[model samples]
Target chain A: MARLSRLVLERLMRYYRFLTETAAKEAVETITSGEIAEALEIDPTQVRKDFAAVGLIGMGRVGFDVCEACRAIRVTLGFNRSYEAVLVGTGHLGGALLAYPNFVRYGMRIVAAFDNDKQKIGQTVAGQIVKPMRMLKPFIKRRKIRLAILTTPAHVSQMLADRLVAAGVKAIWNFTPTGLAVPPDVLVRNEHISIGLAEIAYHLKDQAAC
Target chain B: MARLSRLVLERLMRYYRFLTETAAKEAVETITSGEIAEALEIDPTQVRKDFAAVGLIGMGRVGFDVCEACRAIRVTLGFNRSYEAVLVGTGHLGGALLAYPNFVRYGMRIVAAFDNDKQKIGQTVAGQIVKPMRMLKPFIKRRKIRLAILTTPAHVSQMLADRLVAAGVKAIWNFTPTGLAVPPDVLVRNEHISIGLAEIAYHLKDQAAC
Candidate 1:
């Protein structure tokens, strides 16, 4: 089967959100790629292709059952279950990411946070108390958390990722300056601030020139 | 010409980053869709199709000039430049995101930060001091800064965005729950957090099910 594109995954998520919001008010048995495109300002062909990647077939005129499509996307994206995860580096960036209200809502939990800071070691942020870095392996084993978020300084991202992987993490959302080098089986998503800023800078420059 | 796909733009940004880093150290000439796919583990056809969207032509085996392709992608992404922006919500999140090393490296600058609180208003972060919210418009106008990074609270986002728009903000990277409705001409990219968390939760569920 063809892999679902990130663009498709993103739209599927958006469509799922809209459908849920719509479901609260009314029964939606069918949906159309056109409607999704019009609402999201995305291309209909892209939407169709995304759905097709998931092996879903929308009805010709009747469209897709809104709930069904949402379910399918969720299942494909591994969203239909709950995931317990740990966080390393409970500093500002980590705190902000943990404060993001969507984690638990999406079935991902930050059950514990690890830090070497003496002051922060026992304190709680976003309902997760910080644990000493030494306790990482045991914590992961006990909690059965497979995902980790790294908000450590750039110099330590690789080390932090290694720590998490050693503790049995399969995926990591890295917010450090240094990107990690991990095995192919592990998923690493680098949320680089420089890249985002650079893109924005380029846009602002163009806008100014225009 | 067909518009460039977002995925291509994203990859282009990554490629640009790499080239900017290696351009001085190495003299490279060409790139192939297959090479890019191999490096990123993405589909080769996907690379070709994305490039075609922007009218970037690569020969069968000869591929494309690395520098030229880099330039083409940068132009396509409007990346031959930089942008100056402001920071709001001088709390932990605001401070850390501002202190992020990625911004300047990528091409964006946060020239100033504004806060309503007296304690934080005069403090410095990322070498830029926090200014009172009252000075926002003047600072923005003087710098001709159009993009704003908003880390304000949900209850305040609307009013804050309004003030920013009134001060001539053309784009916003919102880091709050409140979705500010703006004029179509003014671009608003909501880093809609709750939505992000919800998506995570949904993914967790799917993974757990698996």
Candidate 2:
């Protein structure tokens, strides 16, 4: 299978979510690219292309099998197995993510949370006890944890990323505003909260201009 | 200025963040597009184009004035003015966002939080007391709020969005998994947490395959 671009992967993930919901709620056996496209407000041709990219075929007018398409997306996106991850920075945002119910559905399980604050250390959050920063390296090594979710403050995020990488964590889901520098082999997916704000601000600005 | 695409807006936001930090921490007088691109891992040409699009001119060798560039980005992205927004749902995620300190920096102020849960109604999460759902409509109308930050459950998000639209919210920062159906005039930005998981999962899978 070819490596999918980030944009394509995002669309695929949306399709996967839509298909799964359609299958669960409506119990529909098959759905056309047009139906999925309409629901997602995506171009029908793009939907068909994405489906074909994942080896899913439509039966002309009969459309693609919903269950089959879901399975294909799941396999293509590597959601068949579970991924154990650790969470750093047991702040409000971190706590929100820890308590979030959807990570398990997406094949992620945050097994531990770490914080440098002595007050937060040993406190339980969403079933995982917050450990001190000192334990992070040993914990990652023992569990062979490859993923770390960094929700720490901007100033410390890069430092924590370095520590996480040195401890063998290969992928980081950075929720901080700080940009991290990691090795070529490491994957850093930054979730910038400000980007959303920028979009909203721009829209509001545009409206005011109008 | 012409309308910027979402991609351009996102890049502009990153540049704005970088420029602001550089100005504040290093007190840099001038910064080249190459410098910004290097820090952001973006193409220097693209950075220059973005700056140009925002009506910022760079000196031949001295580069663009750092503070000037920041101001241009701030005005372009509409971060120059403050925006009042209301957050729906006072769960951990909602609380986290309510307590988020950077929103002010990005020109967003979550003035109030609302939830249907009776227990959360009178409780204060982050200085602002959680208001009841019944009060949401009147509050938005009274304040003439144009933006709403939705952190509600997936099932209730669309319904609440409909109410928000009726109450005069022009933009919605949706944090739910459910895609909202709003009027064409209204803008909805869906923040899907699963997309990040999908990216991480794909990367991990690709590594395993290699």
* Best candidate (score: lDDT): 2
- Candidate 1 lDDT, B1-210, residue by residue in tens: 454434555666666665555465577677778877776566888877766765678877788677777676666666556667898888767977777766654556788899999988788876878899899999888888899999987779989899899888888888775557788767676665444443344334444545
DockQ of every candidate: 0.28, 0.82
Question: Interface RMSD in Å per candidate, to 1 decimal?
Answer: 3.9, 1.1
Query: Comparing to the true complex, what docking class would candidate 1 get?
Result: acceptable
| Cα-based lDDT for every prediction | 0.72, 0.91
Model 2 chain B worst lDDT window (10 residues) = B190-199
Question: Which parts of model 1 are misplaced by more than 4 Å?
Answer: A1-3, A24-32, A45-69, B1-83, B89-92, B114-139, B152-166, B176-210
Pairs in steric clash, model 2: none
Off by over 4 Å in 2: none
Residue B71's lDDT within candidate 2 is 92
